[model samples]
Target: MEINLIFKIAAVGILITILGQILKHSGREEHAFLISLAGLILVLTWILPYIYDLFVMIQDLFDL
Candidate 1:
């Protein structure tokens, strides 16, 4: 819930996009694709815990 997490995610996304573009333009298209995929997975990994916590909270609230 910290403000810093938002910044971190944004920064990672921007960096990944830039890096992917650089790699692709440099002719390493495959690596660029993999880099983008890895970045997505990495971002998901960072966010998954928070998402799980939210789901747990919702379940508890609904007595599920």
Candidate 2:
């Protein structure tokens, strides 16, 4: 929800893209794939708490 989190996520994405490209061009396709997957999981871990909070808010709003 904060601007800093958005910047952090964008930085991670950019770093991961650069790393993946370097690994792929060097013929380490598997490592590149793993790097991409790790990046995705890392971003999801950052965002999941926000998603959970949203769900909780919705449930509370509806008296669920």
Candidate 3:
């Protein structure tokens, strides 16, 4: 819900794209794949806390 988080995600995406392209072009397709996977994990780690918080909020709202 913050602009900074959006910017961080966008930056990560852009960095992953660039790094993947470089790895692919250098005949390191495996490395590129790894980079993509790492990027996905990194993003998930960043967002997971917020996701947990959202769930907690929903449960509280419903008195569950």
Candidate 4:
């Protein structure tokens, strides 16, 4: 699971970089910026649950 997530992030990063470059060179500056931001948000959405779970576990561990 960890390895898969690592690969997924790496791939997304590479793809976003390539996409941004392509968009910039194509004279779509605004769309390229938005595309990168959208990619970041998408990745964050996917990882939010895991982050929440981690915090919950920590809270329980310390009885917070």
Number of the top TM-score candidate: 2
lDDT of 3 at 8: 94
lDDT of 3 by residue, 1-64 (tens): 7899899999999999999999999999999999999999998999999999999999999999
Task: Tell me how many clashing residue pairs each candidate has.
Answer: 0, 0, 0, 0
* Residue range 11-61, candidate 2, lDDT tens digits: 999999999999999999999999999999999999999999999999999
Candidate 2 off by > 4 Å: none
Better of 2 and 4 by lDDT: 2
How many angstroms is residue 25 displaced in model 3 relative to the true structure, after the best TM-score fit?
1.6
TM-score between model 4 and native? 0.89
- Candidate 2's error at 38, in angstroms? 0.8
Error of 3 at 16 (Å): 0.4
Measured by TM-score, how close is model 3 to the native structure?
Answer: 0.90
User: Cα lDDT for residue 28, model 1?
Assistant: 100
lDDT of 2 at 62: 100
lDDT of 1 at 15: 95
Candidate 3 lDDT for residue 58: 100
Q: TM-score each candidate.
A: 0.91, 0.94, 0.90, 0.89
lDDT of 1 by residue, 2-49 (tens): 799889889988999999999998999999999889988988998999
Clashing residue pairs in candidate 3, if any?
A: none
Residue 28, candidate 2: C-alpha displacement in angstroms: 0.6
